[model samples]
Target: MDHFLTFSLLSLLLSFAAAGDFSDDQLIRQVVPEEEQSVNLLNADHHFSLFKAKFGKSYSDEKEHDYRFSVFKANLLRAKRNQLLDPSAEHGVTQFSDLTPTEFKQRYLGLKTPAFLESAQKAPILPTNNLPEDFDWRDKGAVTGVKNQGSCGSCWSFSTTGALEGAHFLATGELISLSEQQLVDCDHECDQDGVCDAGCNGGLMNTAFQYTVKAGGLQLEKDYPYTGRDGKCQFDKNKIAASVANYSVVSVDEDQIAANLVKNGPLAVGINAAWMQTYVKGVSCPYICSKNRLDHGVLLVGYGAAGYAPIRFKEKPYWIIKNSWGESWGEDGYYKICRGQTHDICGVDSMVSTVAAFQSTSE
Candidate 1:
């Protein structure tokens, strides 16, 4: 039994090490959740009650309530470990405090393995030497308000539309909320490996981009709206508020990703949302996140370096991400991750894609 446990841990460590960021997993990875910590342990019962009342979480019976309470307690411990591993960020009970990790991943995460395209266009290399010290699409009136994905695994659709929304805004100088429901109900394209852009099951951002191109673009949120569930396709070709003229995949380099974000628009990227389940706020920079196993799709809004410490090299650079979980989570429906200040933390920098141009649409 001890040998099996050791082997399992070694395999997990090797998975994390494959990204070529760290040689010693023990130095940053928190394998044991109950390890001694410098911070105060949270009052589980008190927090659990508060979580229930805040989220309006009511179970059918006492048995289910007890089960959920136990899950919430376990999540508190997990949050402590996350807090320790990501000391730069705040971690605690969230709306999903009652859910187990599997439940959370099932309902929230929705990114599948990116499909290799036969003719996928690569984003042209842009100059990054004169990039600004801080950049955010929200500040430029390019990004729309944060929306919710509910209990559906349709985050990829939201991420796909988000990049297009920004691209459309940059092209037409109009910020219009696009539709995720359009993609959720419509896009069912499959790759050679059988990986598809499933509605609520899971999907990839690049695949959704491909679908958007073939479908003649997407409608506005007010025109199509989002239901957060699978439904019949009610697409209207005449109501395409944002149409993709062309799209391209950015390189894995961090500076280039930022350059694309600044020059083009918000870039759609994938991320490992394991730590995000209990994330409260601040900047999340975990030391032991899987870079290759990205499960959730989000938008790369901007990048900045400041707060919590000296603004210079003393702290790792942080990227601002726009999540689809509504304004109740993280920094007003956004997440910040510092990949040891790298571009590939949680695989955010790996599968980056953006709409290079949008078909001209006049007001």
Candidate 2:
């Protein structure tokens, strides 16, 4: 009976190893070496101390501090598990380490998908021949500096404005920082799914674009600044800084997505952002990220290749995603997700859209 039990336990372990089960953090903790686990535990308190200092985090009282400490330790173990799953990338304590995964998702991510994506026009197929090995819109004087969306779930607004800002720059040679607050306050369009743009609650970029076209245009950031909260609409149509002529959806093809970025401007995209909580740096290409469960919206400003080149394609190239989580986050509010040989690596290439035509007013 002891032999039988031992055999069953061995089979279970092998099955878990083969399946790459991450259902429980403790299960993955077993992957760490015993000596290394001890070292990690010993250093966890030290790491948490540094994290609090670096991020300027503090608890109100002893009880809160104790609770936060326990949460931080759990995050450290989670980071270890993530590091193993994504060996090429680095994962550790972040500003969001203290928050539970559910809280983080609710506070930071705010992308609500429409039932059907048939609203936007389809972009024309641009030539992909002679595409640069590395391309960045920032160097070309298009992309604005990184901006934080605060604790608001207004990421969809940022994504929409980022694409429009790039389009405006290409048209008028002016890289103006547009207003995300405008979308958050004024526009509230709903799709067939009945999921409407509810300010800080959540929204979709395509619907925001539609609202932009209908509302005539968007105002400047200085005029309608972000307050990081939902408020009454203060859109001044007379102070329209930029207008979207039309927006279009891009093909799922990576080469075409590159073509759109190079020719049109930055592309607005949706991503899962599941592992982004603990992500600090390096290219984030996790072993198990769902491509359909996109929860956050971001702008695709550029793409580059790192390491070897002779064996190009998926092995080297990566997409540069401009996030709205402030400059203190991953790669200065930017994320590099690896390119796969086939479809996508976390819906980055799935729900892609870009500004087809636009007009911008001068300062």
RMSD of each: 5.2, 5.5
**Cα lDDT tens digits for candidate 1, 1-363:** 144544554566567667456522242344442343333436667777788888888899999989998888777767766765566788888888888888998999988985345567899999989999888889999988999999999999988888988988888888888899998999997765778988999887777888877887888889888888999999988887778888888888888888899999999888888789989987776656768678899999998866362212256678999999989888889898884355577777888887855754534
In model 1, how large is the Cα lDDT of residue 284?
A: 76
Structure candidate 2, residue pairs in collision: none
Per-residue error at 26 for model 1, in Å? 13
TM-score to native of every candidate shown: 0.88, 0.88
Q: List the residue pairs that clash in candidate 1.
A: none
Q: What is the lDDT for 212 in model 1?
A: 79
Best by lDDT: 2
**What would the TM-score be for candidate 2 when compared with the true structure?**
0.88
